[model samples]
Target: MGNFDIKDFKGVIPAVLTVFDKNENIDEVGMRQLISYLIEKGVDGLYLTGSTGEGFIMDSEERKRVVEIVIDEASGRVPIVVHVGAIGTKISIDLAKHAEAVGADGISSVPPFYWKFNENQIVKYYEDIANSCNLPMIVYNVPLAGLLGMNVIKRLASIDNVKGIKYTGMSHYEITQIKDEIGKDFLVYSGCDEMAMSGLLAGADGIIGSFYNIMPELFINIYNAISEKDIEKAQRLQRQAVEIILYSLKVPSFYAGMKAVLRWRGINAGYCRRPFENLTEEEEKEFKEGYKRIKETYKITGVEFLDEL
Candidate 1:
């Protein structure tokens, strides 16, 4: 995203969501408010336009606009890593170059999706993208398309500007394996929100997840507790984090359900784009009640976090 190194960034960085208006266009106002809320709530960094941010659905210019907005709003307060992944290598390269031109801190991408490209082709894709820009690159290991093998990752890591990874799977053993193989200095961020606590203990340097848009402090506190060697506190916070993820999944769509929660907390988190189903009137009521319990009984955070934002 920038002409500098990634700075070995760590701690909780949300793969921040893209707020869309009713017509499925970017809602810049809501997006800025979300970024301000996260930064003010003590998030270490931000991952923009990733899977949770619906990057693939957006056109090249749309993705670039989101990057510009985040870079403008964050204004160097925290590191900003933009996900410039597109199915075509040319599109991804264009996005990565644009990210650097706009002053983003780093750039990241998921491996090619919807096609079973061979290892060599995949490596070449990353190589081209890395070489296209001066920014440090994080290889996104998302299990949805297919888990990238350690051997493949090793090759990808060998790229000069390829600095780290965002592993979306829950395999801590694999995280440790990557650490042992790649050396401890290589940055590895856990992408599963429910497993944030154990993921840190398993050797992940930090976390990047969707839920952080709602309750960043839980993950941040968990990160801090682990650093302080307070196992009990970390465990308690992890459960609270998981409680929200698990219950939120009970709705029609976790993506839409999460936006619903943000609206309840007064963030104007807006709606998920098409094919990511929205909640019905009945489902909306159900989710609202669920959030009330989370706020009062479960004490889900961030309702009070928006005061300054």
Candidate 2:
């Protein structure tokens, strides 16, 4: 376990992407650069090997290597929460133990998917992982797989080491309910970039999403504005974020579009792996153009842009 408390987990944490080389292997140099970049931009923490990092798509050894690389590169500058979620309980526990061995700050896992799991099974799944190691565990509840209701959330929260949740659903009511049930000290990070403002207002402790990799300063500003009770500024930043997000969706693979933007910034974060196509030449052009417009419209500062680079 790391030295960070639950409070340290609050603020803008990026669900960082996994950089792959031309040969479709994890690019250690590129990954290190990205970790340094986000920390330099003042992101509060890093959520690694999650959906954005394509954790499920990679094998166990690949995931463990990424964790080791990120923790090593971060060098204790910021907390790193590794997503060790796998399809089976044994694999998940193995990953959790490995993360603890490598000195990760925390561990999180999505509930078992693909087959319908009863409430008991879900609770047990989380409990098994949480008990596997000393690190605190966060439950990932996204709407795509299955949404945990207030009752289930309360049950999960009751587990001693089950610390908080990464909520990716759209319901603001649920966010409030989780806080109300678990108390405000229980961390609730907004998993969707599009609803970050709404999530903060609904009492989320912080924001966590793939988009933070693009412009972390903007997201940090949003969190700061919300903390200062500056609703107008928060709304403005969120609108800009939403604009970029909408444009990103125009591409076939949103992650690929993000990688393109990074490459344009001179980061050389390589292509998405197989099954996720890279942006077409035309799509790349459109994305770059739109990204420029977003930067100018929002007057985003303190981050490198493609054109400026």
Top model by lDDT, which number?
2
Residue 171 deviation, candidate 1, in Å? 1.5
lDDT of 2: 0.88
TM-score of 1: 0.93
User: Model 1: which ten-residue window has the lowest total lDDT?
Assistant: 300-309
Give stretches of model 1 more than 4 Å off. Answer: 1-5, 293-309
lDDT of 1 by residue, 48-98 (tens): 998899888888889999999988998888888989887799999999999
Q: After superposition, how far is residue 71 of candidate 1 from its true place, in Å?
A: 0.5
Model 2 worst lDDT window (10 residues): 300-309
Against the hidden reference, what TM-scores do the models get?
A: 0.93, 0.95
- Cα deviation in Å at residue 155, candidate 1? 0.9
Model 1 alpha-carbon miss at residue 33, Å: 1.0
Distance from true position, residue 238, model 2, in Å? 0.7
Q: Which stretches of candidate 2 lie over 4 Å from their true place?
A: 293-309
